[model samples]
Target: MTIIGWMIVFCEIAFWVVIVLGLMTRYIFKKKQLGIILLALTPLVDLTLLIAAGIDIYRGEVATTAHAIAAVYIGISIAYGKSMIEWADQRFQYYVTKQGEKPRKRYGIEYSKHYFKGWIRHFIAYIIGGGILVGLIFWIDDISRTQALSGVAKIWSIVLGIDLIISITYFIWPPKEKGISSGT
Candidate 1:
């Protein structure tokens, strides 16, 4: 793997470690302020990856799949980080601290709405990440250097389209709730 690939892996690991530490501090140790501080630092990991990728490109290195993926990772982190943190916090609160109710499971129309909302988040991530790839392609100003990023963008675009189709199907055929009858 390239340096960018290693950096991406490190960033992912750092993000989760920071999240767990933040949650542990908040719930396990009862240090709310410190926990918030640690949680807020999650973005730093993304920033570090972004800077590393930028520096690599600035050094005249050709952009690789790893570099494109770094953009996607940063975009996803920015778009979903808060919700992910909330998700983890809810689980920690319910299972570890025992202070809140268990997270509720959605069904029927509610599940469809949830799925749709997730698709919207994915769209946002695509825009942000794709925007970065385009910007990098222009900045590099060489087709040979940016082919990997363009390929990633094309693949991601297809994935987004497929996701939209699946999400819409959730609305067309909403999931049935357990133990509920359709009045047949």
Candidate 2:
């Protein structure tokens, strides 16, 4: 893997690590302020990745798949990071701190709604990430240097389409709840 690839991996690891530390501090150590501060730092991790990608492109390095992925990662993180953190916090509160009820699993129409919400987040990620990729392409001003970014955009667009279809299907035919009869 290239340096950018390694940086992407590092950023991902750092993002999760920060979240875990924040939650642990809040729930385990009872240091709520420090935990909030740590949780708030998730954006900084994304910013760092963005800066690195920008610098790499600015320095005339050919953009690679890793670079394109970095943009996508930032987009997804921005779009879903809060929900993800909330998800973890809920689980931690229920399982670890025993302060809250267990997070309920959605079923039937509720499950479909959950899927739709997830699809919306994915759409937001595509827009943000695609915009960044286009910006990088324009900034590079060289087709050869930006092919990887373009490819990533195309592939991500396809994925977005597929996600939408899947999300819609959940609404069209809501998943049956386990052990529930269909009046057969």
Candidate 3:
């Protein structure tokens, strides 16, 4: 198998482990699942883009496979971030209703610091993370990559690093809530 092929196998294995571990934590513990679900799907997202981008890379349509992978990571980060933000909003609404407070209709609010996260924060975070990934890819592609495995490894590491960093940031630095802000 080619270096690219081996790299794919390595990533797939890593993703499978993450998926299983996430499932165990979310399901067994009956935990809030939005973030865990996103974690589980990262590998699938990466795999899909790698296959698609590999073709373009071979054809020289993309500057490199890394470029294609970077684009895919950006897309997935945005989607996953949006989903988690929405889930948190809905969850907050449910809690408010249960507590006999009027739930913010057609908008979100931070009832508490823990519950006061904003979707726009997620949006901005994803944008910044994606920007970093794309920027690095562009930087790296300036040099010729003779060893496909090494170049692919660099790409994989970048994507994985961004994923970890973004996930941690969201987990640790969740958005602070303001007044029951509604969209105009």
Clashing pairs in 3: none
Cα lDDT computed for each candidate against the true fold: 0.96, 0.94, 0.49
lDDT of 2 at 98: 90
- The candidate 3 region of ten consecutive residues with least summed lDDT is 107-116
lDDT of 2 by residue, 1-184 (tens): 9888998999999999999999999989999999999999999999999999899888889999999999999999999999999999999899888999899988899999999999999999999999999999998999999999999999999999999999999998898889997788
lDDT per residue, candidate 1, 31-144, as tens digits? 999999999999999999999999999999999999999999988999899999999999999998888989998988999999999999999999999999999999999999
lDDT, candidate 3, 60-91, per-residue tens: 54244454334545444554544653454445
lDDT at residue 150 of model 3 (Cα atoms): 41
What's the distance in Å from true for residue 135, model 2? 0.4
Worst 10 residues of 1 by lDDT: 174-183
Q: Rank by lDDT, descending?
A: 1, 2, 3
Model 2 TM-score, 2 decimals: 0.97
Better of 1 and 2 by TM-score: 2
* TM-score, ranked from best to worst: 2, 1, 3
> How far off is residue 115 in model 3, in Å?
12
lDDT of 3 at 20: 46
